[model samples]
Target: MADPLDLFLAAPPGLEPWLAEELRELGYAPQTTAGGVTVSGTWSDVWRLNLECRGATRVLARIAEFRAFHLAQLDKRARKVAWGDVLRADRPVKIEATCRKSKIYHAGAASERIARAIQEELGAPVSDDAALTLKVRIDDNNVQVSVDTSGEALYKRGHKEWVGKAPLRETMAALLLRAAGFNGKMPVVDPMCGSGTFVLEAAGMAGGWQPGRDRAFAFEHLANFDAGAVSDLRRLDGGTSLHFRGSDRDAGAIRGATANAERADLTQATQFDMAPVSDFAPPEGPPGLVMCNPPYGARIGNRKPLFALYGALGETLKTRFAGWRVGIVTSDGGLAKATGLSLTESAPIAHGSLRVKLYTAQL
Candidate 1:
């Protein structure tokens, strides 16, 4: 039997612990790191992680690791590694190199050497446009080579094709949902749903659906891919019945969210309506969670109007939704406080160029 491969699940900054917790729930022992979580598994584990993990931006498998002080040694060692076991001679690959505090100070030169080695040894064509990527990092004279098993960012999910301005990524949405203590059992409500990302993700979790089911992965191009095993892994079993709801003031966003729910085959479990936060109300039955990512005003260049919006949202939640939990995502603390809810803030999270946090409360 081949040794287990080292798998790295890339998490957004400040969400490592939540991602690690999610991985542990999936029955894998994960060590949380600054940027992500690391686990030891085989190629089959690689495919499963890419398929099941919702909070990971991507999954990278460490193909080779060694020490090289200079370019000659790097090229020689790169060529000696067996690339044929994972990469195909017919498929093109893209090489991306990062050099940090290493004798190999020039990243472009290192990438060129590795690219040439793959061409000469594996007979594979390298192209910048290729979807399959090999990430080479030289840090403190330690060289690590990894392959991006996820072709597109897992946030794509191939379900919600429409997005509004400065939309929340689906991966981040999943992690935030986990952070909010959602376990696929409670109902979810998003009053300011942009493209219904939170609603759709909640419905998927309740439906026992795989986020990667409707998509393709870069691992399919690798030599170790098993078609039958992947087919078996994609088979889903029982799921609980839950109603996830969302509403938006924008008519276009409502239409798009409904379409996205249809595409995900989750319309029965979700409902997107055209309504503002002032008109928001909890669905019938026991109280669940009210989660939303409202405007932060950084993009709008004004913070005054958002205060009213947040205050109105807080008032609505407090007045109508009794015994429900609340989670609001935003970059501004003052805005989050404007709601007047007793909320606790999460660690600073990297959202594009802005740093945001998830504010939680129970009312």
Candidate 2:
């Protein structure tokens, strides 16, 4: 049996607490820290996280750490690492380095040294286009080396091929749903569903579907990979009743969303239609959560007409969606206020270059 590893679940800024909560629900003891949550487990846990955890942007294994004050010392210690035990000789790898408050201030030089060490010691070719990456961070003379087990970002979800402009990432959507207190038992409605990210996520949760069942990870190329063990992790628990729905004014968006649902095999659990917010109506069942990511003029164009759009959305929810809860993601505070829904703001989350917040309210 191999020794346990330090597993770090990377989250977006200001969403670390929610991600930590999600890890706890997954039956792991998680320690929340800046930018991420940390836990300890073996290779099986790594595979399980990549396959099941929805809120994590990346799952990294902190394989090695040491102190190095100079380049020669760094190179010597790097060469001493048992790279063959963790990395493969046939697969190409990339090295990314960052230096902070350390004597080794040159990040490029540090990356080059590590790259040379891997090539000489493990015989693995280094390339910028490699899917596997080794991250080196030097903080106050302490060097922490981790491997990005998740090659592409986890938000890709392996099934969502089509997307609209200013689309929300799957990771962020899951975490926001967590913050909104959504489990799989209740229905979820997205009024402005672009490609139906929230609806698809809700259906997957209710249907007991693994997020990475259709995806591939970089860990498959590592020396510790076990195909049979990983395959066993995909056993589904047989999902609950379906009650997810979505709507959009654009005909093309509805078509794309329906296609995405079909690709995920979640069509039985979800419904998408072409309707503007003013025409939005609640599902016939018990009241659930209403979530949407509306245009905030920063990513999409014009801000003026958005005020009227928000006003109509607020009116529809207030009058039609009685006994329901609401959550909206927008960058502009004024736009959120235009809804007039008595919303409470969450901590600002980093969305690309722009920071956005999730506004919640009970209608």
In model 2, pairs of residues that clash are none
lDDT of 1: 0.91
Quote each prediction's TM-score.
Answer: 0.98, 0.98
RMSD to true structure for each model, in Å: 1.2, 1.2
The alpha-carbon deviation from the true structure for residue 163 of candidate 1, after best TM-score superposition, in angstroms, is 1.2
Going through the candidates in order, what is the number of backbone clashes in each? 0, 0
Candidate 2 TM-score, true structure as reference: 0.98
Where does the lowest 10-residue lDDT sum fall in candidate 1?
232-241
Please give, for residues 163-240, the per-residue lDDT of candidate 1 as tens digits. Answer: 887788989999999898788889999999989999988888777888888899999999888999998888444355
Error of 2 at 242 (Å): 3.0
Residue ranges of candidate 2 with Cα displaced over 4 Å = 236-238
Error of 2 at 189 (Å): 0.4
TM-score attained by model 1: 0.98
